[model samples]
Target: MTLSWSDPMFRSIVWQVVIIGGFAAIAWYLVSNTSTNLKARRIATGFEFLGRTAGIPIGEHMIDYEPSINTYGYALFVGVLNTLKVSVVGVVLATLLGTLIGILRLSRNWLISKLTASYVEVLRDIPLLLQLLFWYTVLQGLPAARQSFNPVPGVFLSNRGVKLPALNWEAPHLWALAAFVLGCVATHYVGKRADRIQDATGVRPRVWPVALGLLIAVPVAVWAALGAPWSIEWPVLRGFNFQGGLTVSPEYFALLLGLVIYTSAYVAEIVRSGILSVPHGQIEAGGALGLRQGVILRKIILPQALRVIIPPMTSQYLNLTKNSSLAVAIGYQDMVSIANTTLNQTGQAIEGIFMIGLLYLVISLSISLFMNWYNARVALVER
Candidate 1:
């Protein structure tokens, strides 16, 4: 007998259902057995313990969190904040420095190109953890407070860390921050308008003038109008230590420096490759049209190269953020450091590890999502 297309025999639906059911049964069995075994071993489960007191001090909390009063959840929040603080600043600085180096690596000047190449190679070859340790050691070896290196009258550098002038923010400072944010938004829109103008009329708008006006001029005007509510408190060597300034702890500095240097090497390579990926014909054509080298680079190459550079750079940023967990190695009191302390003090290994994993996952996912949006904006459409 021949089977028709609609025949039940022709479909594998029943078999598919059976296979899925079998897998589900196995999973259920495994879970049940594991739970029983854990219970027999007197191991606890669930996240109810998160509400309990953490009873561990987090040394560098941005929020008002005390070990005696705060819950495990609050402690985790502090850790997350510290991680973000290092990661965000590191990402911005690394990208800026790396792109400059990468562009330099492609320079016609032999010395500049070779020097950048050497920097990328040398830094990339060393382990990041080792680099962190090295930086920490260097900071530790700096002269004591009495003999601290003073690059400026207000700034002091010692084994403890760099002490720089801290700005005391007042009402005017809030206005300045608001103005700065507005400037960034305005610059973005200005760039978009310039692109549209270029597309329609082949005329490149002077983006720098507009950008400078928005970013600097507007912010300065607002700051001046608000009477500049900013006071600089400088560090002074007093009583065997520096006092009255923003002290960047050695651990924090070492971690930041290590993360920046290590991640910058990868970012530099990404940028160099992205720029090189741009067709030489495009540059020659820009030159043929009487555009200066700087104009060609700024108006043509960078915009195109950014699309290619951004995705991989995003991965590097994620790596840097994750690698910051190694801050525990040097006692930085980052999330991992404090979390480990909590685990030791409370004997809550499972809860601590889960918290650490979840915090990292959230950070990683957020960065990835933002990068995706940016990538979508910059990605080219092909016919």
Candidate 2:
């Protein structure tokens, strides 16, 4: 049915069209102006510059990136990898530390609770940039190589960097890793079967112990069968410094430290609020049903609290990811820093900024999608 010109719905549609057209016109103006300005200044634009060689030096990179041999594309790829490395590790450590501090904040012990509270207040209140600079300073101010701080026999920290024992892998290590993967698949199947059994019999089977045994036993048996083809490559003190082990650069260490500490404070608050959002009557009900404290916490409390926790947790994760761009300040070769260098070298400012924003947008969207899927599974759905 067609609506009359005087109908309310027809008027509403006309207004919506007008608003959208206005927005489109504004967008067109901006783009046209930008193009004109670029042409006036004779500035190069477009993504083709990515293929050109990047003569800039990157101090720390996950992949092989020689300034003379690599293209801007390769350097950007290394930057992306470094960004992911720090973001992933920072998220995990922040969540664990945050959960611990959150739980401690609710502890009955006054001193423990106060200490955790103070930590949250101090860290979260301070600017994250300041914290990053402070941590970088601390790491860079350590003793020189000859007088390096040796926390343990093979582990050393100094102005040079942090060195720890590295893994020396061989053929048997592959076999052992394959066995471990198989064990994980088996364990998942076993857990599903156990859940089915519980639904039918009202008795929960001891699945975790069995799964743990399979994980350990299968890996060990495979390693033994293949003669345990792996060894620890320990760092050794050579002429002026230690060598032969894995070294974490000061920039990375500082970036990780700052992000984890700062983000964890906010995560702690989110966790605490999530736990408290559960009704007190539920805890009393669990106790009355003869469930132990651990069982109540694990089976009842965590499941409900997770629904509230995950959505906000996703936000913190995205924040941590974007904040990783701050690595440029301390000379860490993250994607943003590389993009900036690329911009300077090629004089392609617009293309460089677009690529940096696009990379971050992709990362944020990926995390958001995964968290949304998980949240759907765990959310409280009314029947």
Candidate 3:
């Protein structure tokens, strides 16, 4: 049968095809133009420069990196690792802190609520870059290693960094870590089994005790079996700086602090709004069932509020990740910073830029996919 314009479906299909074709045409033109322009400039292209020596000094690296010996590709990988370290840690800390602040914002006590409100207001208003700069400056103003502040027996804070006792990781630690992971998997299955039992028997079996055993007891047992070797290397004053311990660099600390504080404020608002979105009647019904206020919020309110909270929370997570690029401002070598350095030295501006964009795109998409999956899990399902 021939389609007619009068048919709504036919018209919709035609319009969608037109829009898609238009976008495709424009994309092709832009690509061709870029290639033509590059050719005219006689600039070298492709990712051949990635193999060349990087010779770029990176202060804080998770992986072993040598500036003079490492290739540009390896340097970029280190930069990616640095970015992931900050972004991942920041996301987790921001979520926990944000959830607490959001809950406190709804407290019955006026003082607590008002204080939390002010916190959200001030942080949301202040510029994150300024906050980062302020934190970095404050860290810089701390006394040098000679007059460092010893907070704990093995903890020292100074202009150089925060020195904490380092653990001499042994093979037993790896076995313990593996046991912990296995415990988590067992706990998940146990929880699922409990849920199925509840659905079938009209009563839920307690999973927490079993989870605790699996998550904690099993790991401890594994460590003990392997002869847990706990060795601590404490920091001691060297000539100009502290040595023989784990050091938290000022740049990383400031960046993490600024991201967590700033993002938590926004997350607080999201949490508050999500909780408030739940109808008062639900709380009343929960209370009528003789449930405590905390239980009511947990069992009834939060489960419902999550539907509203998750979508926006995903955006906050993405923002926190992208904001990590600002690490360059304070001399923290993140992906963008290192990529810029690579571009400058290699003169492969196009390739460097494409790689940077691609990396961020992949990272952002990964976060989005995970959040979306979790959201679906928490979403209300209708019979």
Candidate 4:
């Protein structure tokens, strides 16, 4: 067989090969160049340094960490965990706050709508880092533990951080958590079965009763079966600072507040746009069917609007996660901050950067995949 340049298929194949080969060649050259430069500078490459003692002090580690005993790998792993904590909490808080503001934007009251609109506009326009700095500064200015603000019992807010009653987590709590997760899975199947039955019989089976049992009763039963220990460790003021309970460090709180507030503004716009995309007829039809406004918004409008909202919401999530790297600025000791420290101490710049990039790529892809799956679920399907 012979291939001619005149053949379109042959031309397309040749161009694709050429483009791919060029990219491959460039990548190879860059790798070789980095290796050569590193060798010439007597700077070690690869990840051998990860086993070395970190000897770096970290504040507010989730797990037990000591600079003297922990390896660089363990430090980096902890850093990744810190990053995830901020990103996960930030995403949930942002979604709730954003959704509320988004709904208020549609309110009939002029003041409510305008106030929310102003909030969104102001937050969206400002740089996120500046907001973080502002929050951190404000929190730093709070009075000492002795003069801490007590807005509620068992809660203390001060320069040190926000301290609240801490629960004694035990093995029973873990069992209860597992049961709750199982219950959620069961509830999902029940809802799916209910939907199928509704479609087949023109009568929707009740889902809430089953959901209540699965989501609540089962978890409680499991907890009780294991002794259900309940105790709160209260923060007590001692030696100019509060001790005991769980303290939310100022750095962490400020970082969380900044990320949630900033990202929520963008998310609010996405939600508002999604809601507005729904046809007015959809609302009128729900009203015609004697459905209350809350029911209409939840059962009809929001479900349909999710089809529009999820894709953009995923972007906001990624942005919020990535933006958490700015925790370095506020001394939150997140992934990027710790990675930079490792890079400096170990001089494994390339490896440090590569790991950081890889972690974020994994996170972003995970969020995107989940959002895409949900988007498909809610997408209008032809019967």
Tens digit per residue, CA lDDT, model 1, 1-383: 76565778655776778899999999999878977876898887667766888888776777899888899878878988888889999999899889889889989999999999999999999999999999999999999888889988888889888999988868877787798899999899998999899999999888998889888888889889978666888888888788898889898899999999888889999999999999999999999999999989888998899898998988999999999999988888888887788777666687788788988898899999999999998787668
- Model 3 CA lDDT for position 237: 94
List, residue by residue over 1-383, the lDDT tens digit for candidate 4: 58999999999999999999999999999999999999999999988889999999899789999999999999998998999999999999999999999989989999999999999999999999999999999999998888999999989999999999899888999999999999999999998999899889989988999899999999999999989888879999989788889999999999999999999999999999999999999999999999999989889998889989998999999999999999999999998999999999988889999999998999899999998898889887869
Full-model lDDT for every candidate? 0.88, 0.92, 0.95, 0.94
- Model 3 accuracy (lDDT, Cα): 0.95
- By summed lDDT, the worst window of 10 consecutive residues in model 2 runs over 44-53
TM-score of each: 0.87, 0.95, 0.92, 0.93
**Which scores higher on lDDT, 2 or 4?**
4
lDDT of 3 by residue, 145-211 (tens): 8999997898999998899999999999999999999999999999899989999998999999999
Best-fitting candidate, scored by TM-score:
2
Q: Which scores better on TM-score, 1 or 4?
A: 4
Which regions of candidate 4 are displaced past 4 Å? 189-210, 221-228
Residue 261 of model 4, lDDT score: 99
Off by over 4 Å in 3: 1-25, 193-208
Worst 10 residues of 4 by lDDT: 373-382
Candidate 2 TM-score versus the reference: 0.95
Error of 4 at 47 (Å): 1.2
